[model samples]
Target: MLTYSRDEIAAYLDGVVDLEPTPDAAGLLDGVAEELHALDRRPGEVVLVALANGAALLRCFFGVLLAGGVPALVPPGTPTGRIREIADRIGARTLITTGHPADPPGRQLGPVQVETLTGVLPQRHEPGHVVILTSGTSGVASGCLHRFSSLTRNAARHARSVGLRADDTILVNLPLYFSYALVAQALAGLVTGARLVIAGPPFTPAAYWTAVREHAVTSSSVTPYMVRGLVAADWRPPPSLRMLTVGGESLDPATAGAVLDRSPGLEFYLTYGLTEAGPRVSTLAAHREPRRRLGTVGRPLDGVRVALRDPGPDGVGELLVTSDTVLRRKVGVAEGRVGDCLVGPDQIATGDLFLLDDDGYLHFRGRLSDFVVTGGTKVSLASVRRIANALPNVIASATRTYQAHDGTRFDLDLYLYEADPVVAEEVRRELRRQLVRAEWPSRIRTLSLRDLGHK
Candidate 1:
């Protein structure tokens, strides 16, 4: 319930967002809200910021909010058609991209170039300006318009929880659109007045290390992919790094250990949550006392709650979330989280399944809907897949597919790779034993595991 006033959020900027056109921005933070208010004719207006760097998007985000407009900071890699669809679906009249200003705004585009954006507008939590959508990785692009306060509240609470200060320089690797990557690195930096350094494009390893060295970043946001990359490269993490937060996808235990081995003093943590819930609902402190929970997603943070519902005497049902940080509702879309809690006392039913141990640590299970009932009893394919994956040099993945032969849902496809066929066959047999009798797969095909390496 901590609401930000006027545009206190934008004034929180620490470094240039490094836009494509690059605004000669020095101290533009002063009267931005007022400036936009002077020209803005509507409230709750949405601004589509297409800035390159995370801070760039944030600048426009704060600019829009300060001006009384909701800022939907667009992420990188958005296709043009999707942008137009979103704009039309939301009835957006103004677009706040980079580049030269225009009257009619030229043409419609869902995919935008950062170097092409320009202009600022009034702020409001109205219908638009606020960012929408949690994980853009899902099918069809969408958004969840969050109040500036919600984003700010997370930053403030996180800074306090992590002991972040104004002197910290957050190294930015993930896009600002990724709620986890954006919130932990960009927003947290702004809230505490820390320097910002954008990480490189996805496949660029050198650029990442270069940024760390040049900017002297003390903290960073990352995922399992980056951790594996550092391990593969045998990276020597700069001693300047105080902490690194990883999420979006589960970080394999092996990769986590490898990362720690590479960088002795660097602190690592696993965060869990999605876009619909303002990114992080839980976090493991960097210096968590118990050393680190091997397969746990940690506990809920301030303003968030996690609960479990038992399906029966046999199984755990769902992981529930209740939070003000959770998005009220998604605009211009359907079939997602609707008006908070869908059932029970929990405000949000995370499709992801989980179980709380006697120790209070929550262990992640597979998606509830992902369970496959082959004979009579239902089996979690995720568990089966995880087991198959545990075999040395063997990786496993499962896909729930509809069969034309039986016209029934089945977890028929399980993709696994092992460099040697001898080992692959061993994996298939092990899977048969690991999975229940009813849970045995219909087909087990073997192929080259090198291409799609690890799941």
Candidate 2:
């Protein structure tokens, strides 16, 4: 099964989760877990944790697992209405939220407020299942049900991959709701008995620098957006920083180069995964082959395998991951029952396109839906969006593949946010410099702040 043994799992589930404060974290977590267990209970019941990213939220998160209940995590500051909707969708037994509850009879447990929902039958699942929400870029967000042991196993694997140790302090600036942050960062930190520093939702260069320095963070994870932000801000990693991991978006070679140039000693690992696979598929040790193999997301972790589903002539295909840690099933999906989104047992169709090279590395092409056939040529919307978003005046960008109204030919449309005439011209100039003719967007549409707001 590759899952942790009973004693090994207990080492983490019952062990002290080291946090920034270092001393009081254990006692506080125990108190919260004890108080949480004292409440009305049901076996295999699902509990919704809608708290922000901090010790309190993590305390509650582990508290649920310790108290023998399932936890469905939502982004901190998710709207109350939305939280309730997810609760109903998942058939949760209780809602654990921050701040005072509007209704009476809600019990206050330390910093969190718990409101029990009446008559909503809790969803059925095997014991120790944890639900993490998907990004929902393609459709409605679904809760991926993963066995807690599998998640910890994945975390342990990832921790070993990154060489995490007990003396290391892992900085989790990303929100806890994200599987990358939850499993790869938070749970991985716990698995290794590493100290964790919960830092940001509103990430700034100053705040990030302060966190790294103050905590002497040895390892941390960031998205491509954060990588760009840090590079643009001329961020210099502190001497204590030893390892940095990048995921959640494609890290272009140029961006990766810039990050390495800034901190030559840092071990940067580029990773790839989805919510369906317990969130970590592979990781490239960029520090080893930073320039030569910057394009690949490395090989699958130990006990994990990757297959190309229906590869085309060019060898790109939707990536399928086979691992013991793949989600058991999806909850809160449209089907209103478990297993609606199950593609196969112990396997998941990642829905992301990739190329498996002869040397056993996976090169991420783009999302399966992000590629479009235009003018007999396959064009990548993800590539188009990446190019447009790199322009100076572009705040954000999107791409669309469409056919001419008369069905004459297919073309790509590019949308750039907050672009003026000069910016549009700059984009065209840059596109010409970076892309070939067929790959170019047929139309360049400049969208203003107000226009985007209306949408």
Candidate 3:
């Protein structure tokens, strides 16, 4: 069971938590909490948080929670117009951010009250919890609502199951807006009384390694791109580093192997989940049978149940998960009656296709929406992207089906990020060698990271 309370978290961070390039994070958290309580914001009220990663972000997040307001964390670099849109979509009337000229104090930023926190004001209820926005990769972004009790219910068990220690120092460089960073990195570190290290933006490979070596950082969270960058730089970590977790996307077998090869003594955790599942459902601990289960994302986390729905002949099916952490979409009443109200369904259909082996390991195939049929053959866009990303200098790839204006045949369109002409040719050649003719991409276009909506 998880024991996470506001008081407990405050006590845990009383003197231990450290935010680099800043002083006394614990004192800052207390002061921010106090300032938020001064707002007299009622419980269940919506507040938009648009602060960058550092002491201010942490302070404001916990402050809103402690003040009994539902806080929605927006990405650091979100534009003013989009921030207003998000706040309006969520019915938020209050916006909290760092003091910027655009967001003047005592002035309304669009339709919301702009409350700037220059630093912790002074020092400071809780049915309403957190609101996490989806990546909006598909289209319109939706908010995933999570109760504070539900989010922290299994946090302690999760930390223990993953071998996080109180003495360990966790380095988190990911955007704090995402659930992965909020729950897995910040909350987990605080709950376990671990020393939290926050790295600022522009997380280059050199800065990451420098932080790790300088702070003797023991654990850190990473994405596939970050891992690829580390491997490309041939950077070897210090002995103090013990755990490295990879998630937010599928970890290719080659990338996983390369990570393990470089850090033989380090424990690599390949985790899998969506934002709705409090962002983590399963983790493959590399210390146990490291190479044997390179492709599998391992079993479910403690207190979480996993089952397959509609298994195919090959046993692949949609992954269904039941956990206390699953978010229930909030339904509002219209015209004196509730419309299509659900009693909080026990299981969430992950919309992810997976196959569980007899040994109980789960292999992620791809999202059900990511599969496309070309020439009567089903091809996984994720599979194609994985293959394309394996090519050298390829940052990332996205695949979709396209058709000519006057053509009948459906063709695969592959978008490669940060790939030069030579790298694009190599990707095409490699894809031809690895995939069937029907599954080969019809068009491969190189694109900038901005073109793909990545920062």
* lDDT scores in order: 0.58, 0.71, 0.65
Q: Clash totals for all models, in order?
A: 35, 0, 3
Prediction RMSDs, each to the true structure: 12.3, 10.6, 11.7
For candidate 1, write residues 291-370 as lDDT tens digits: 45756777777888777876655456678888776665566543223324345432667777787766666667766444
lDDT of 2 by residue, 1-455 (tens): 22334345344544333233322334434555566567756656788887767776776776677666788886655545445556777888687776425355567665566777666677756657788875332122357888898898999998888788988888888878878899998889777888777866767878898888987889989877778778888998999999999877667788888888888889999988777788788989998884868878888898798899899999999888899998877676432222333467688777678999999999988764544434322344555565566666666776655546311133433355645677777767876565534456676666676655645
CA deviation > 4 Å runs, candidate 3: 1-7, 11-40, 99-128, 136-140, 330-344, 370-455
lDDT measured at residue 156 in model 1 versus the true structure, 0 to 100: 66
lDDT of candidate 3 over 57-112, digit per residue (tens): 67667766766667788765655544554555556656666432343454432222
By lDDT: ranked, best first: 2, 3, 1
TM-score for each candidate, following the candidate numbering? 0.69, 0.75, 0.72
lDDT of prediction 3:
0.65
- Please report how far candidate 2 places residue 183 from its true position, in Å: 1.0
Clashes of 3: 3
Model 3 RMSD, rounded to 1 decimal: 11.7
**Pairs that clash in candidate 3:** 33-124, 34-123, 34-124
